[model samples]
Target: MSRTAVYNLPARWLHWAIFGLIALEFAIAWTMPDIHRDTRPVGLVAWHLGLGTFILSLMLLRLLWRGVSGVPDPHPGPAWQDRIARLTHALLYAGFIALPLLGWANASARGWTVHWAGWVPLPALAAHGAAWARPLGDVHQIVAYALLGLIALHVLAAAHHHFIVRDGVLRRMWSSSR
Candidate 1:
């Protein structure tokens, strides 16, 4: 296995930060029913909606970073393997960007307020969409599940390469140092 520079510290921080928040958000949002929309306590929903806003912002900035700095080279792999890994990462990015917007859209369409980290209020995207909210909400949920699936495959593949296959892919991502 060859060495490649790990992600930049900022990218790494954002990656792991969003990763933890997303995992927590999914666990809470999926396991529990939608907080009666109106009856749910502010503290709890604040975290959910707040983290979702954070994810949205981080993903946006990450995309801009990628557009400018581009993807860091992975530890060397076969052409097909590299392509698959790249494609998978692209899918994850797309999911990261889309899921939050869908949730926001659904919320917006329903005229709900989104809080940023429990403090800031986000502008609504739509006036109201009584009928559309359910479907978009469904889309948001479905995509969240899809993101989990892709994320699992990604983590498993990273682990497999690092442990079983004795590859340096994990090292390149695990830390930014030599």
Candidate 2:
């Protein structure tokens, strides 16, 4: 891959950082005790909440960075394929941004305090016992599963480019250095 095709250093960094955090969040979510009306934000639940907030903050930073710096020119490809790639990227961003807010709102409804790393307090998205926010936890879970599907599609597409299409698409955002 040519150096010019690569994303800027911070974009590359944030991409991987967010990916790692998302993986960790999923693992914690899978293993943590099931959330209920009486559940307290402790242990894995606290970690999950803090990490979700952190991921949301990083994603917002990433969006700001993308806006100011913009992405490198896309790898040349068939128009339809390019469109699909763009859509996939957009959906990924949407999912990452939305998932946390849903979780946060649900947390708020449950009267759970969402602190950043167990110290700094983050604002609640909904009032305690808010009916509107009650369903968001389920929505969050459903979207999480859908986002996993999108992630799988993304990896498969990258693999196709790397192994079959023999394109440099994967390397564009793979790392800071080629």
Assess every candidate by TM-score: 0.86, 0.95
Q: What lDDT tens digits, residue by residue, belong to model 2 across residues 81-140?
A: 989999999999989999999999999999988997556898899999999999999999
Clashing pairs in 2: none
lDDT of 1 by residue, 42-121 (tens): 56555777878888888888778767665566667688888888899899998888888888877777667887765788
TM-score for model 1? 0.86
Which sections of candidate 1 miss by over 4 Å?
1-4, 31-41
Clashes of each: 0, 0
How big is the positional error of residue 87 in model 2, measured in Å on the Cα after superposition?
0.8
- Please give the TM-score that candidate 2 achieves against the real structure: 0.95
